[model samples]
Target: MIITHDLTKRYGRTVAVDSVELEVREGDRYGLLGPNGSGKTTLVRMLLGLVFATRGEIEVLGQPVPKRIQDVLPSIGALVEGPGAYPHLSGRVNLTLFDAAGAGGRRKDRRQRVGDALERVGLAGIDRRPVRNYSLGMRQRLGLAGALLRQPKLLILDEPTNGLDPRGIREIRDLLDELNREGTTVFLSSHLLAEIDAFCTRVGVMDRGRLVLQEDLSSLRAPTGRVTVGSPTPERVVALLDGRVEHRDGEVLTVRHDDPGALNAELVAAGVTVTAIATERRTLEQVVLDATTTSSDRVEAAG
Candidate 1:
């Protein structure tokens, strides 16, 4: 439901985002991963029409951004940077004000919607408490509740897990999963690799104002096994293979290869006297780091 073509943004001479071409299909939960100063927030702002792009086009929910942002934005709910809340106001009062400000339901209906949102974010009983009195996690949930007040078709979240505890993180993860299952498109920007791995189906990695890589999380995380062999002469065992051997740790030699049978035959033929053999699969974090490093190397070489 979101598309961008060569979306470039600049602040005077400094390029904040460069030729970023992206697409999030309907019902897709896409994660935008990047480090600080990587222009993720700038890109999201351009998409929301809060900031203008230097060049290129952006469309959200079938409408061009900036040109028809007012018309299109009603269908989008977003939490950028942090939750916008009035410290002095109680949580329910804050949502009540937002309901009045947005164009969604009648007064009574808006009240009901507010209550529903608070409950969904697990703040039903504490809505009467002032926002300043709430913890960081509570404030995050409150922000999410405000976003839900609009009953948006697409939810754009920027670091939704920033200050959340493990429990709060899980709650938000489960909530996003449930929303995606119900057909809400989620476009999430996060620095937490584990959060992206657990919550996003697809991901785009950005570095130095450019999109380094984009891929389906499942494809990126496809299992590649690692076999560790304990032998007397680990160096000799590694020499048996051309260069498939990765490293030697203490008495164990770790080798990564897709075919287990080939590895075993080669090890036995080398007469290394294997004492123990163990296999391991790569986790999402390892896969992402590998991809990011490869992208960085390619960019450096191209430059």
Candidate 2:
């Protein structure tokens, strides 16, 4: 569980995280979505107490953060900005050192734990090889193995699939799903909207450091059917629909009506001379763009 109220972080008058209030409930597979440098990472670091907020409050797992961060850390596993390893060291060696470095007094029979982590991330056999020789995806998995070394109860991953190919991404996704099903509350951050749509139970959209929307994925994606109505009588059709239309371009009217047949029938009854009627729907990408896009975002991206 996590909660933040009016949380903000600033660097020399540049606001990285601005008044973000976020909550993650128990058993939530929550995804944090945002463009690059949109404050998602800053917020995550604050949650982990790795970065201090410029203003406002933070709590994690029922304790005030940074203060009780120690009390809650054993329960949390995190992979932020990826993991680093000695280029010359074997994957197994790197993980073993990491285990010793931050075992948090959970240092019992760590050799077996390291083996389990490497096996869990699909790096068991190859782990004895030098990390410099491993593929990008393998290194990413090595980072994941480090996070899993302790069998943490809460997983906080930032762009966990950052450089993986499709197959590797799917592997990571499946692993996260398995972990979540096994009762680890997951807080994931990524630019991969489709992946989030596929695996996340809840989502938070961020733009310019603000949390613009937070909602359950099922309800957020509830089938709101759409239709494209193009008729010679476009004006009359618009009047009939009463501005339920989402888009209008020339002769096409993109309306958000679930029952296309009923709408067509109604239009016919009104003598609207339908030329075209086609179904459409919104994707998570569309929803996120609609929710977070702003003039500033475009300007910032352009800059």
Candidate 3:
């Protein structure tokens, strides 16, 4: 439901986003993974037309951005920077004002929309409490409620779990999961790998103002069992096992082996002294770190 072609944004000589071409299909719990200052917010802002892009095109819900942003934006619910509210206002009052400020939505159903949003985010019980009295996690939920007040077709949450405790984080995760299951397209940006691993169906990793990797979560985590064989004669052991060694540093070797048992047997036959062999798998954390590390190395080398 969202697409960007060669989209770029720059401030002076600093490029916030560089030639980003991205697509998030309908019903996708797509995660934009990146560290802070990696253009996650910039990209989202450009999509929302809050900040104009320096170049390229954007489309949301089949309508071109900027030109048709009004049409597309009304149907999109976003909490880019997080929730903002009148500190003195009660929770209900705050939500009431937020709903009323919406560019679109039936005026008659404002009460119902406000109540539904509050209940959805578990803020209904604190109706009379001032926002200033609410905890940070509570504020996060409140902001989420405002974004979801319109029951948008697409929900864009940038760092949805920010300021949330573990429990609050899980609550938001479940809420997003339910929303996506109900056919809302969820596009979220976060640096937390565990959150993406648990919540996203697909992910795009951003680094140094560029999209470095994008893939299905399942495909990325497929059972490609790896082994770190610590052996005195690591070279002979790898040669005997005919294993595809992907990474090697010092005497430590990481080899891709479908069957560690078979590889172990070959190593034993070759009489290679093995000190350690532990079955391992790549986690989403590793994938993101590797991508960013490689990109940093490349940039440093060129400099």
Candidate 4:
């Protein structure tokens, strides 16, 4: 649903985004991963036409951005930086006003739209208290409700779970999953690797203003040629496997095996009591660390 070709943006001599070629397909829950100062926000803004690029091209929903952005924007729901709300008004009132301000939805259906949005974000039957009284997490949810007011085709979110507890985060995750299953393409940007690993089907890593890596989450998490086995008779397992046993600690053995099922069968048939066996896979954390340098916020003085 989104594509960019060598997209770049510079602030005088400072380059915030450099030659980023991004591809987000329809129905993809794509996650954009990066550290502070890596230009992820800048890149997202450029895609939405909130920030213009210095050179290169951008097409969102098959329309050239900034040129035909108006045609495509109605179908997109976005939460960037954070959500904005009128602090003095109640959450429901704020959302109602926002709906009226936007283009295209019917005036008669605005009330139903507002209530449905509130329900989706876990604020159903919320009281008439002003937004100023709501907690940070509540405000975040309110922002999300505003984004979902239109049942958008594409959701572009940034730090979507910023102020919530674990339960709230999971709730938001499940909601996104449901939306994706219902055919909404979700493109979110976050620094939390675990969140991306758990939620996204595809991922992209950014560092020093460049798009460093992009791949499917499943492919990036492919198994290493090894298996971790837990056995009570560690000595018997080691002796049977011999050179295949690369490392051992107590009952746990790391063996260089391609298939865990075959290894487990072999051990059981050989009278080695196996407690557990599983193939080891490269973690998303390890892959991201290898693909990108230190967080751009870090600074070391010259020696």
Off by over 4 Å in 3: 223-256, 260-280, 294-303
lDDT of 4 by residue, 102-190 (tens): 83289999988998888899988674789999888888888888888868899999889998999999999999999999989999999
Q: What lDDT would each prediction earn against the true structure?
A: 0.85, 0.88, 0.86, 0.91
Q: Which stretches of candidate 1 lie over 4 Å from their true place?
A: 222-245, 250-253, 261-303
- Which runs of model 2 end up more than 4 angstroms from their true locations? 104-108, 223-256, 260-281, 294-303
Candidate 3 TM-score to native = 0.82
Q: What 10-residue stretch in candidate 2 is worst by lDDT?
A: 294-303
The sequence of per-residue lDDT tens digits that candidate 1 reaches over residues 49-77 is 99999999999999999999999777888
- Candidate number with the higher lDDT (2 or 3): 2
User: Candidate 4 clashing pairs?
Assistant: none
Name the candidate, 1 or 3, with the larger lDDT value.
3
Query: Which of candidates 1 and 2 is the stronger one according to TM-score?
Result: 1
Residue 9 error for model 2, in Å?
A: 0.2
Better of 1 and 2 by lDDT: 2
Q: Rank the candidates by lDDT, best first.
A: 4, 2, 3, 1
User: Ten consecutive residues with minimal summed lDDT in candidate 3?
Assistant: 294-303
Q: What are the per-residue Cα lDDT tens digits for candidate 3 across 7-65?
A: 99999999999999899999999999988888899999888889999999999999998
Name the best candidate (by TM-score): 4
Task: Give the winner by lDDT.
Answer: 4
Worst 10 residues of 4 by lDDT: 97-106
